[model samples]
Target: MPRRTGWRVCSVPGCPEFSDRGGKCDDHRREAEQRRGTARQRGYGREHETRFRPAVLARDPICVCPGCPQCSDPDSACARPSEHADHWPLSKRDLIERGLDHNDPKRGRGLCGLCHASSTAREQPGTFGLH
Candidate 1:
């Protein structure tokens, strides 16, 4: 049946850790714990981190934002190192609706934090009718 919550030995066989947080002991929290509602719940799991993220980073090592902080000129390049792998369409809402496929090589853009934030903000429905 269900193991009552409190304190117990680690679920891992022959392990010695324990916790009251859940079934898993302290050491296994990162691997065993699942956030209530987020991309993880929606299928963005360890596979994405272990495989998809690295592949994406390797594919595009630089931010591809165009005229990022300001669009004064179309040819401007941010050239900042990519700190985030952003969706090509640049909307997480759309990405969720479209179902995130971390494996889709062409679906993302390597973006710096500033550029990614700016682009995402611009995609909102009220920014200069950009939606």
Candidate 2:
């Protein structure tokens, strides 16, 4: 008969104990948890922003640029249909002063990439009125 082996040790570098699922020791597992928590706090851990997606869905999927209508085309070689979520009516200084959150529904709206670029350029001194 074959002899049974004991619990497998953690595979994470520098870890010395076993984990049933993650291959991490308890200390490393806790560290990994801490890292995940920090990432969530910083807004990089989740796939969807809380408000942006629903708001965009509620509105037409088309770009909101005046005189220009386009759909989202994530992979299009052409620029018109590419979607960009942009902050409206708010200057960079305003956003910095208010510390606007990117996910805030009241602070953002959808636009085409070209329109977004144009709006950004309009905010620059030399580019104003050019678009």
Candidate 3:
């Protein structure tokens, strides 16, 4: 039997580092963290708030982060003071591929800011290219 190398290139585009965890390298991890930080700072826009508030409230204000079941109560399990009404249904690339016209109210979905930013980043041409 031959020894099999488990190392692989990072999943993040343009990165050169190698890793076995999700194919992401240290640089990608740092880039992702920076992007998340930027997204958190921007917060959700007025359109998202006005349009998705009712839907999010109706479903019980929550963080919506995978593996996290916390509500949106700042004083409770949900430490985050604000919860973003993320586009749950459509992905960023899906929106881009479908064009802006497809991002109609009828196609929107809810998600937390963190998850939303992460999803949106996937559609960008390069890492942290959402600007």
Candidate 4:
């Protein structure tokens, strides 16, 4: 007979998801994590999530990848619904040090899931600080 280890399902009513990390499923866990992020991850405070992020989202309702190398053709650009409100050119660290509100989303840019993933992976992965 094989030895047994136990994992539990999410505590949310009717949820069948399971995880070894906690009582919540991965989705719920991630949701809670986002809500409980450190100051920096949560963009320093309420202003970032409540004010800045919403404003940016409203300003750029769709992705603006103008057929660049990472995107498609200018004539037929990927104007997908933006999933991220990113700090332009500057990274999160840069913004934190210089102050998150200094620009008020001036350089903010909207990006789709694909664009956001590519940009973050390229800028934040193994070769970080190399650029």
Per lDDT, the best of the predicted structures is 4
lDDT of 3 by residue, 95-117 (tens): 55776533244555445666456
Residue 24 displacement (Å), model 2: 46
* TM-score comparison, 2 vs 3, better candidate: 2
The TM-score values for the models, in the order shown, are 0.52, 0.39, 0.34, 0.56
lDDT of 1 by residue, 1-131 (tens): 46576787877788788878755677666654343345666556786667666766777788788767644555887777888766576354566677776446567778788777787776664442222
For candidate 2, write residues 62-93 as lDDT tens digits: 55666442325434323344376565667434
Off by over 4 Å in 4: 1-44, 68-76, 100-103, 127-131
- Judging by TM-score against the true structure, name the best candidate: 4
Off by over 4 Å in 2: 1-50, 57-60, 67-82, 99-102, 125-131
Mind giving the per-residue lDDT tens digits that candidate 4 earns over 6-80?
788787789988877656788987776666766565445676677667777789889875663455465665778
Ranking of all predicted structures according to TM-score, beginning with the best and ending with the worst: 4, 1, 2, 3
What's the lDDT for candidate 2?
0.57
The best-first sequence of candidates by lDDT reads 4, 1, 2, 3
